[model samples]
Target: MSVDEEQQPSVIEELTDVHFKFEVKEVLLELTRQADQENTLLALSVSQLGAEGKMRTYDLTITSYLRKVGLDYCEIRDSNNQPLHLISSSDKHGSDLLKVEYTKADINGPNFQTTFDNTEQNLKVELSSLDFLLHTKALLSTINYLNTAVPQELTASKDREAKKQVEKAGQGKTVSKGPTNSNVFTFKLSAELGSFRVEVCDDRRNIADITIQGIDGSVLVQAKETMVFARLRDIVVLDVDPKTIHKKAVSMVGEEVFSFQMSLYPNATEGEGYSDTSKVDGKVTMRLGCIQIVYLHKFLMSLLTFLDNFQTAKEALTVATAHAAEKAASSVRDFAQKSFRLSMDVKLKAPLIVVPQSSTSHNAFVVDLGLITVGNSFSLMSAEGFSLPVVLDTMDVKLTQLKLSRTTLKQGSPQTDIEILQPINLEFLVKRNLASSWYNKIPGVEVQGMLKSMNMALGQEDFGVLMKTLRENIGEGSKEHVLDVNKQVARDKAEQHQLEGNEVGCLPVEAGGGGGGGQPAAVTNAGGLGENIVNMLLNLEIKEVVVKLKKSRSDQKESPFLVLHVAQLGIHTNVRQYDMVATTYIKKISMKCLEFSGRWL
Candidate 1:
């Protein structure tokens, strides 16, 4: 029934009903009344029409059960004080035998009642359990309907759409912060990795370039445009088959441009790579970022291992070619094998590594390994007959302006040719010690054992120790730690200066004309080392030759054995070839050294 809003009542009557059907053999039991005009007594009878069942059996059973609990009969009424009359239907296909009608208001009314014989409390509990079961079944059915009725693609699309909106909003918020003087891109991706700030350049809404620098503003990687994703994809290919051909093109929209499996530490919560693109408020926006703490740590550890490997590889190569070396010197019948032992240690101490402006070469990349100090010792020993052991110890060998580059080869199997893009600014040692003595005085076996021990000391354990020390001194990510590191650096510099001021050997050499002074002059031209080398070669000015020899034996301030020291060496050359400039350098050579003392065996 429906009613108009104006006709609706503040409180409306609700209907509640209870129906019970009792089977008496093939017939149903229903409530009936006697035919007496003055009598108000109720009776039970078979409900099925044309049914013939004895009334005595059902009457006795029901009577005994009702009498046992004193719940005589069931009666129901409406809000009014009148009993609901029981009406029998002619067609009882789906009709209940005993049905009572009542209003919700009459549940507690004096005229309304429902009676259950012998097990009323149990029936009430069963009704509540049935209701709960029905509710649960309905809820499960609804969930199943949703799963089956809605397509998976549609659901996934909806989720992607929602995520896209969120990402776009975030992108807009970050990009709108404005640009600085050095960076003009308004859509820059700024992120912090430990104490380093990673700035990603935006190219037409794509992450095209990246620059990493310390918090102190020292650039680790220059802000040069590059195929960032392409390079990463190439690196990823190294894990698979390097010869496998893949799509070189990339895009910022739609599916991911590139993806690589990230190696994670055990029990890592997050590190899986991700990329996203979206459009919000009629403008397209995009984002690409990675959180790779574990991978970064692994890479740094690998770098340390690489440095250690350099020394090990040299020693291994020398040992591997020992037979060839002996064969080359087979003239003398008693000629024995010569062994070369080398020890090298390379460390990165607060280095400012930089990837300078992109190379103009067709297919090449440049990396400037700023200033590196290589501490090494070289020893050459011969066994048995002709025995002269030559040992050279180099102190603080500094290689500066060392730019390493790679150019992709165009022929044969895919390979990148490594090259030094710039001339290495090699500084001659301020101190050198060389010693060559008779090796026959020492046992050959003992000398070999010493070299073997040196090789063993350069194992992974030593590398691990070095890395641990570096990590300890690297400082934390916080500003406070950076401040503390800066203070420590200042203190170390002050101490170094104090010591240098007192030491006579550390004193600066005078810049004398014609023959240069003791100390090698610092490259002070603003145009850089390459420019200076080019200018010197073009001008052809021969001043002095500085010869720095490695030290051997003990590192005491003074040693008996001395190496050749060149005070001056002048070369004269004239241009003879018109086509070949470098080929026209055949000239007279004049050399001079202050001291030379060594045994000529």
Candidate 2:
């Protein structure tokens, strides 16, 4: 009856308490308490949170850890000995957040305080180690995201490097700078191989390299991504000695080493650090002694190899079948002034090589292209007649003194092309039809007389009979009368000077009336040695020969074409006596023609 009578008001305070313990340095235990009179909790511990906290499996209660920090019974007193309290409530913060205040007191109540919100930083934790066997079985998905990115920074850096190259070696010429966009490379970290690989491929290039080792380790440090990125110098210090590593590359909670894995946007680095693996930049020189192109072709896959120096490689390329067909009709004033139309299709062969001529010189090379001609044609038109179409079905060409230079192919565009420098020498094996117009260009009289003489010399035609036909065509009676007068004049001159510079293989024959001393007299069928050895040129077929063909001195401007620049080698052949029989035959003919003068007349 008294207990019920004692509860007079509904506002009876209930007892509330909290406690904590800390086995910290020099401190056995600490605690935080909560009083039944006040709604606020108090720290009663003496140990610091970070200094005393260990990564150990212990109690999970909030009050257990809170007591270790020792926040209860901590207070400030004023001059009047008045106690002060930090007054804060969870309701002051919005939902999903908790705010707490630590206040200090002046002569007034609680004056200075600092507040903390627990929801400001968000951290994510994922554990894939729980299923390590699944990862080994290739059943885990490690790909976090797929992204396509343009590496702007990489492109700018590459362009700057290219510009420097242009200025360094260029002589008033702008080299073709190709597109700087590097091929897209996908990166993968495979738990199966325990390695990471970067893969890149395209029409121009391909690269698949393995890298990033020693990465499987325990984490020693973790920080907010915002703080790490924004204030990077605070976390990492460059120019540090290897000895004083603690000065900071990474500040870990323990002494274990940490491997850093950065996931950045694609536009960060210079997409790929390889322009050419052999030589990247600067001036380079190259030399080769007795090098063969066929070997280089097999080694380089495609055939073309660019060298920065004698040993430093630039680029290796394959032959592209793409051809450029050109049709040109122009007056070739160099030789016989012919108007010609040339339809040529230019094609490249794999493994074009330029070898130096001597040990001292480096500018020249032996250009070996194996073969190029397949369907090229040439046609010439002149005042004398028109030539039949000449087709280049198959041919091989070797050249010397070849040079290389850079030129802009598509001006104002991104790339450039390589062009051969001028004055190249060519050795050729060309097969084509001998146009009848070529022989027809000879004067009709000269052609008729030469054919008749050649036939007589070969014993195929009668020399006496040929001379009789020619005399009839030219009116022999009048010719003989003029010859008598010329013979008399020659006789008078023979008396004045000695016969030192007489006609080759012939003495001046005294005519009955006049003499025709300058011209070669007609041959007669006298059955002599000269008749058996005529036309020796038709007896031999020359397989190899060298002919120097040059343009007329009057042509000031030159063209990069076979027609205008065929200098050291050509299709023309020179008849040379290789056999003893041919040599003997020639000597007999020369001696017989001089001995028997009246027979030639």
Summarize candidate 2's per-residue lDDT along 1-601 as a digit string, tens digits. 6876676422222211333344333233322223355332222323322112112121111211111211222233324663221121122222211111221112111211212111211222211111011110011101100001224455347545754654443233343332232221111112111222222211122211212222232111111111011101111112122221111111222222222232222112112321122222211111111222211111122112111111111111110011000001011111221112222233323234432221122222223333332223332233343332221122233334333322222335764323333333344434332222233232111000000011001111222322433344234334534544466467548744533554321211121111342122211212223212111122222222222112223456322211111111212122322332322112112111323353321
Q: For every model shown, what is its TM-score relative to the native structure?
A: 0.14, 0.13
Cα displacement (angstroms), candidate 1, residue 67, comes to: 69
* Backbone clash count for every predicted candidate, in the order shown: 4, 21
Q: Give the best candidate by TM-score.
A: 1
Best by lDDT: 1
Worst 10 residues of 2 by lDDT: 319-328
Model 1, 552: alpha-carbon shift in Å? 13
User: Looking at model 1, which ten-residue stretch has the lowest summed lDDT?
Assistant: 123-132
RMSD of each: 40.5, 42.3
Report the Cα lDDT for candidate 2.
0.24
Clashing pairs in 1: 393-551, 433-551, 433-552, 434-551
